[model samples]
Target chain A: MKASLTLGKVTNFLGLGFFITLKDLFTGKLEKEEFKNFLRKTIVPLVSILLFIGLWHLGAKSLYNIEAKFKIEKALQDQGQVAADALKTCMVSGESSCQPNTLPSPSQVWNSFQSLLRDHNIISADKAAFIEKTAAMNEKRVAAGKAAIVYTGRPSFVDQVFTSLQTVFAGFLLALLIAVPLGIFIGLSPNLKSAFNWFIQIFKPVSPVVWYLLVFMIVKTLLIGSTEDSSFTISFISVGLCSMWATLVNTAMGVSTVDKDYINVAKVLKLGTFQKIFKVVLPSSLPLIFTGLKITLSVAWMVLIAIELLAQSPGLGLFVWEEFQNGANDSNAKIIVAMFAIGIIGFLLDRLMLMIQNWVSFDKTDAI
Target chain B: MAYLELNNICKTYGQSDGETEVLSNINLKIEEGEFVAIVGFTGSGKTTLVNLINGLIKPTSGTVLFKGEPVDGTSHERGVIFQNYSLLPWLTVGQNVFMAVKEAFPKKNKKELHEIVANYVEMVSLTPAINKRPNELSGGMRQRVAVARALAMKPEMIIMDEPLGALDALTRGNLQDEILNIWGKDKRTALLITNDVDEGIYMADRIIPLRPGPNATLGPEFKIDLERPRDKTEMNDNPNFKKTRNEIIEYLMDIGNERKSEAKEEYILPDLVPKDFVNQFKFGR
Candidate 1:
């Protein structure tokens, strides 16, 4: 009886009871208390999110209208008759005023998302028609052993997302290729670590913008005589350089601090140098290396926007910059839409890395 | 010729200020198929001696010979069961054993390798947990995996460094019997390092006491002439067991007393005088 009681307590402590309650609720056998608890758990977060959106809807209107109007009036009130006429037009027409440009409410952002999707559909149709018209000519060119003409239309919102993903992954791959071996080398030899330490320290904290400029200079020179696009290469290289430090530092630390016992085991087993590293050192240090990779990936993503914008690479960053420059009434709303898209994608990327980390790591609890 | 030999082995650790000698003038020889146990206190450098035998570490000055050849780097011929379970955490129990088997017998087919791993894992009675990783295992279970991994490698000699030190008494006894059972067949040359005197006598053909360190060395060896398949219950009443136990205890006690006095001698306070000593003259040194 005591054992059963203890088991019951343990199960309850681990919240196994909550799952049982959920099962019963689904089966229409839940008791009053359990039903209430289930509803609280499920419905509360939803309700809170709705409440938050509602608050945002109200707050954005009041903040944008009054603040933007005040700024415009204060700036233009001292000018002249022309300024007075412009101010009158701005105050009379909501879209003509600066308020809509400053802060777009939830409804406006939602409308902008819908319009962007519509624009994407139209552009996609146009691209399809262009491809169909060019198919015969392109086929003839292919038969003649010449390259076909490529589509040169402006990328849509969705296309920009794909471009951003491509850039970040390319950059992350390059970082991994460079950092892991360099880290292992530095970690294995104290002399090498000391030799590289000054370089790492000097360059690790250099801003992504500076890295972009440096990469842009080199890539521009390399591509000056070539007709191919250099923006993608420049942006990716900059992203890779900017994010390489995290992986390098973490990998080195991981390799250097591997448990001495594991190394001793490798010795006793008489494992070859290659076998020892691949079978022991790498596996043991994987958790730290993975942590570094996750950080590197996120950093690569965070700076990819700035890199893309500066380099004029086709990505979400460029989309945001273009919209900001457009400064139309709906441009502000579209930019807001892009911001949320970036945030959501960033969150999903992190989750993807976490999933992979958990899958590979033996110590699953320590993955995060 | 002895299967393994350690001649005048000495090890010193260099500190920032000075060198602290851990083991000095250590000499031992184990004949073929002999089970030897070295018993010592926690700080008596038992692990250092084990490392020396396993070729994991080099003695500051001396020679370690295996079958008349001087020990250099580690070789697959000498298998070690570490005090801490050194089974790779990422590898499953079967995979852990398989890794060693693969290394030792690289020419073996995949099926043959799997059989070797399965056989060892079964020997340790961890067949059910073949797929489970190290972190999922209990402490005792993990050590059993380590044991299986080391044994599966089929080394000519085995070195166990406090293999059961962290286990509960019942688990320790269980593993001790398991080791002895494995040792009975073919009786490969083996060395067991332990702090437990009873355990040393119970498992080994001969029990050698290692004196506490700061230049610690082997004291004496006691031979256990008990019959095969010794039962713990019967050993309690056996005269030979009693005699061996008492002899080891007495020798260890003598070393403890000697070390205690040496420590006491080193604890002498420094003599110093300050201008304010007159104020506390009653307590002045």
Candidate 2:
């Protein structure tokens, strides 16, 4: 019993308490108070979400009825008595007849999620089959001193998710690369800070769409003759430019406001300029810089959709846009699924950054 | 020859409009392995003087020489213990001391350096919390880490700027004894800057009073001739301790009175309840 208790304690400390708490509750080992606390934390949120879905379901059903009525009235006006009776039959026939273009039910969205997963799997299998079918031809071409043909099919939904992840990461990395050194440079000297201040102020508030246009123009010019796709480069540059300001501003602020005593400590230690910066300034300013980076990452994710939509890039953003334009029977439901996916992914990304920030920072207050 | 020397040191803040002279025409010399404390009220430029000695800041005029060499900038020869406990919050107590030890003795191997850090941490009885960050430690513990970090560097001289001023009385006295114990072992040249007169008398061989600013200067030096390893409670009974304490307090009081009179020179009365009402009240109308 003692051993099990210790194990429970260890798991709790490691933040893997959910499973252990569940097990303990089921096994009648958990105290009554703890079980109450667990229910309050977990079941409360679940019940609220269920309630939200119920309201959406009711609202959607009413909207669907309204749309059916509108279609009936329109048919009666266009084709007189005969069309009115036919439209009445269509409404009564339900699944076998015309369905109104209204908000999808919760079940429809769930079915869409499952269908997208199935589609992703089927598309992946098709790609595999295509690759296998082309293998012999490709081998012959390689032997005949010709380059092998590459598969150029549309990306699956899962593939699009990965593409969005990759794009955002690339953009975030580029932003960090540009912002940190620039921040340090501006932070170190008042002259440099003042020199860059006007440029920063003018450019910082410009929208990502404007940035995308500027990047697109430059990239189109540079890659005019090149066969390489320029969308990735254009989107990344725009994302980097739009998102870097938060990090840049925060890093400069953090660096400039580092405590004077720490600076004095550096001096008393006779630390060289390089050592002082790396040891004192950077470490001290890291909490604020991390905060900026978190903001920049979220900004990058937010800006990515517009860039992808405009650039016609293959990512989740483009996926959402394409689904909206598709306007098929299930497209609305698929779009709803995508919306939830984006929100959940954004929340997860923020949580991931928070975990890293907490790990790096000595101050526990920065955890939130 | 003095281990550290300040010849006609002067420091001024700003220029042209609103120029304030913090220190003026200060001359001091300290022999090798001597512990000296400069005591004064707040804004008396004791910190500025300590900064000058540590080479963290420069004197606007006059030369500060360490071992007959003119101080141009900061060096590893002087290590300072700041009042605010200048341990990097991100670094553990051990790491804070290790950083200084590593900087001071770059040639020392990793194991040897670790030993140095551990030794000093143990000196302050913070061995258990050596791996803890500054935020996790109490104020006294944080200050102890600061002390350990400064001492671990093993600088030629130690400069403390009110190191224990923020700590409670019990913690302050305990740390004072710990510091004295460490000092007794090596007898390194040390200068403590503080406003507490008794703290100066207890810790240093000589206590120097810095008169109130603006343009604060050293007033007089009171030597504490009490025996080594002095007991805090027993010091109350010691005649020499009483004499030194009285002398320093009397000097401080005189300077305090002088400052009050000087402030009165530029005094102006407010028109509270009207001047006529005050005159009427005075005349019992």
Candidate 3:
């Protein structure tokens, strides 16, 4: 009886093991297929980037003399050390004394990030207490820093990224608000179209920097007056004006490109204004409109970065500028890393916009 | 009173150097439930006449009365099937038909609307491909969808502008039969624009020839006077069908010969003009 019971237990264990292995195999197959698709989409781009990095590293190592190469390697090593020391000190003593002049390496930034995550309460505690003490102080700060980047001198890469993203989105949204209806008006009526044609022709070729400057000046004169900190106002105005042009041009073109047959169909049906736009015009023009939007979004991103760099606003552009200004010492390697991070973030932002365009795009077969 | 009337219609295009005329003195009265076929050669203003009736374009001098009212623009009362198969590419066959049905019967419940569309689609034998888009469909299928869409509306008048002109011989025969079968049941007032004499004889109560241009006009109307439900093979044997087909073909052949002579005269003009100028001027000198 004892032997039989033991044998039965052993068989059950084996069965369970087999079942677990089967489940794992199924899951592994699914994951592998998904990963393969992902790789198919990204492999060419990844290989190209790796090749570029390899070439860059090779050039730096081989083209430069031994001493020059050593200097760069030592600087990079020093940056790593600084990051480790800063992280160690922050963890041990609950404070950071790292200077802004010295750029932090990847490891240093990671360490700082880990420390910030741990001590989030410490940063917010004083503010919470201050808010309880004086509500007016919170309002003043909120108003002042609402548009500005609310970062300490030692801001994380995420803070910079989030700030830039917020600015770009805000400007893009504002551009859409201004452009779409105007575009429709222009597209529908000959009089409106003729009136706007000259304006479009004149303004379309104008540079974004020119638009930025003009808008900045106008906003300053009209609303804010001469203020020491006009960074936020200037950044918003410049980005908004620059991005708005693309959306306006695209929206008008999209609406105009709608099939004439659809218009006749609308007339035959006697669809109401709203119904006509929603049912006929909008669907027909969707492909063009989405393409326009893609172009507009990319332009908005580029404009936001330009404005941030030029205006000294808080964003990845500003972060890059600050790192570059800190000199060709140990921080140069950190600046290069920041450049890579910026590129990756921009690529991701473009892809996100592409996904959105895909989501909203009318199925090609559905077009009348 | 005529269900639709065209009184002394005329259309002239330009004023000066490049003056062109499309149609002149077109007069016709279509009774309710009458099927009329207007046959013409290419660029013979067959389309122009239909467009005037559909109110896509207006005559330079005349009026079109629909049910005792002036026809202004496109309406649900008159459904037009264009030669190009204007089935909204984005919509499926069912949806294309449903769109017309929905517009015509806005108050209809979903079930009623679906039934009406399905009935029309099935009438054209497109039930299997009802969910397919125009692009997904064959040319014949797409044209059938267009036909189904028109018929589903249950319009007072159906205007077909060479709707099956693009189809192959087999598909054309099939669609022609399908259209005739559908028309036989309801007897809706239909004006078919086609170049095919056999098609006119098979489908229409009366066949009218549109003469070739520099201002095309309607030739003498020929009444089919044959029995209902025309069979393609049997109609060939029918004496009336043969007589009418031959008469129409002979008339077209005469016009074709006249056009060729005119083209020959045009080619000969340049050479003769120089010789005539030299003789006249030299004699005067």
Q: Considering the two chains of model 3, state its CAPRI-style docking category.
A: acceptable
- Provide per-model DockQ scores: 0.65, 0.69, 0.24
> Tens digits of per-residue lDDT for model 1 on A1-368?
69756665444444344555565677898778877887776567669989988998888878876776675666567786677667657766864444434677898899999999999999899899999999999999999999998799988998899999999999999999999989988887899999999999999999999999999888888788999988999999999999999999999988888899889878777788899888988888888888999999999999999999999999999999999999888898899999999998887787777767776876777865
Q: Is candidate 1 or candidate 2 better by TM-score?
A: 2
Candidate 1: docking tier: medium
Chain B TM, every candidate: 0.91, 0.92, 0.89
Sorted by DockQ (best first), the order is 2, 1, 3
Q: Write the per-residue lDDT of candidate 2 for residues A1-368, one digit (tens) a residue.
A: 89878787555444445667677778888787998877875677679999999999999999988998898888889989898888788778865237787799999999999999999999999999999999999999999999998888888888998988888999999999999989988998999999999999999999999999999988899888999888888888888999999999999999999999889878777778999999999999999999999999999999988898888888988999999998888888988998888887887788778777777776777645
Weakest ten-residue segment in model 1 chain A by summed lDDT: A8-17
For model 3, residues A1-368, the per-residue Cα lDDT tens digits are: 69756654443333222333333456675466755554554565669978876676665544334433454456557777665555445435634332223334444544544554445455456545654665666577778875432324344556677888888888777778888888878877779989998998898777777877787777677775455777766787677667777678777887887877677666665567887787777777777666666667778887777788888888877877886786634345545655666676667666665555554554643211
Tens-digit lDDT track of model 2 for B1-285: 788999998899999898999999898888889999999999888888888888778899999989999987877778889989888888889988998998999999999999999999999999999998899999999999999999998878889999999999999999999988888899899999998988988889998899877898888688889888888889999988888899899989998988788765665788676457777798985
Superposing all C-alpha atoms, what RMSD in Å does each candidate have to the true structure?
6.9, 4.9, 12.6
Q: Which residue pairs clash in candidate 1?
A: none
The better candidate by DockQ, 1 or 2, is 2
